[model samples]
Target: MRFALFSDIHGNLTALRAVAAAIDRAGPLEAVVVAGDLVQGGPRPRETWEYLIEHGWTLLRGNEDEALGADRIIHGEYPPRFRAAAVAQITWTRKMLGGEVLQRLTGLRESFRVATPAGDLLVVHSSPRGTNDRRGGQHNSAREVVDGYAGTGAAVIAFGHFHSNFVRATAFGLLVNVASVGLPLDGQPIANFTLATATSDGWIIEQRQVPYDRGDELAAAARNEMPPWPASEATS
Candidate 1:
């Protein structure tokens, strides 16, 4: 069966909607899975949550997703600049989300596994082991990527969080990164997703990039005046 695998939607309703429309056009998809970081990027934190819930997305909790429910981001002895940004965004995210939505975010797990026509498929925000792991996002290597899911007993693995993209074949099976539906590595930023399934010949995967009402999303972000970082080619 075909499934739409998407991740890191980050509150850009335009991007999400574009991808959703694309999926509708491309279907008959059997299921849908979102790896996470579902909100706290563009604007409309609550709206994004509601939309996803209404659409019944199979969800995984991202780092930002978890931090939104916390009292504050955990400041360790040492953290990088980007991590500090994550903390600030998450702190703001907690404020943006309502109690019920925050609680729902809190309830999300780091990963999930299911038996699909394509054998066993695993979904996680980053990797099967560490939610914050960026090990695989760098090299674009399958063996390296699958290393994170080594003991998970899953044949196919899908995840996001690097805002990058890669598809690889490993000893276990196929490793696919759904790319980011909001932020992206090409520096282009528009949203993208992946379709993965098993085939008699082998496993096949496809990447899809969809267009949306960027001007509207930007207008909302500008109105909110949230997050210090200005919009860039890769982010909005």
Candidate 2:
């Protein structure tokens, strides 16, 4: 069986289209899963959410997605250093999405486990510990990376949140970050996704990058009057 996994779309329809085309080109995928961050932070948030809903992709909730249904932060719920612009974006996103979209976003699951020919695949927006686990993505070193999934039961842990693509192996199991579909922070202007094929012997994982005209996305963001910080997840 083959599975196509992508995450952190962040509401860029152009990038999503390019990734979809790439998936078609890579054809015969058993399933397509959007790990999280389907909406918020760019042009056409409604369109992106609708497209994902229409296509019936398996979805998970990201931090931004959770914020869509939440009230503005009054307490110290998030990082103390979190930017005001991000808070503003979340507020604007919640207003733009309205009640219906917020309901949809709220319905997304926090994680998913799939049985594959190779073994079990655990998919989550961040680490299995929870959605707010920063260590899952922002590991300081290789040992920290290995320690992040110390007790996960699955043979493979697939997650997205850091917007960087990497596959790592530890004594516990294998961890894969499928990266971002809309906003990649790896200094690359390309969209990314991962394909995992299970065989009798083991599992084969391939990361696919599709180059699309980011200028189009930028233009859309400008036309929508979205904040400039929406362009880059890492720097923003």
Candidate 3:
């Protein structure tokens, strides 16, 4: 079986649509799953949410997605300094998403797991421990990454949050960072995702990058008075 995984859209509908087109072209995928961060950084929060729902993609909640709910103040989730901007953006995103969409966002799960012949595939926005775990990035050592999923029993783990992509194989299993679909901070300004095919030996995981125009997204940000897109930071 073949499936596609993507995450960190951050409300860029243009990037989301471009990635969807690419996925469609890839064809015959058994499933298309989103790791999270569906909204909370760009201009078209509602539209982005709607597109994902329309496609019926399996959804998981990221820190940004959780912030859109009624309990918007996520304590200890962000640095003390970035809290104000984070809260402001959350408020704006919730407004753009409106009450109904915000409620649906609140109901999203933190992770997802699927059993494949190769083994069980686990998907999370960050780490198995929690959605806000800081060790779920390329900045950490390989041992640290593998250690985070110690008891999950997932032979293949796929995730996205750091906006960068990498694949690692260890005794624990295969760890695939599918990367971001919209706000790609891995230097390449393009949409990113991962395609996993279950095989007899193991799963064949491939990282995909699709280019899309950002002019309209930037214009929407400006028109919506959204906060300036921050530089690549450790948080979220």
lDDT of each: 0.74, 0.78, 0.81
Candidate 1 TM-score versus the reference: 0.87
Count of backbone collisions within predicted model 3: 0
Model 1 lDDT-worst window of ten: 71-80
What lDDT, from 0 to 1, does candidate 3 have? 0.81
Off by over 4 Å in 2: 73-82, 141-147, 230-236
Pitting candidate 1 against candidate 2, the one with the higher lDDT is: 2
Per-candidate TM-score against the hidden true structure = 0.87, 0.89, 0.91
**19 in model 3: Cα distance from truth in Å?**
0.6
**TM-score preference between candidates 1 and 2, better one:** 2
RMSD of each: 2.7, 2.7, 2.7
Q: lDDT per residue, candidate 2, 12-122, as tens digits?
A: 787898999999899797889899988877667888888888888898998778766775553234465655666777776677677888997978899888887678888
Q: Which model scores highest in TM-score?
A: 3
Angstrom error of the Cα, residue 152, model 1: value is: 2.5
Task: Give candidate 2's TM-score.
Answer: 0.89
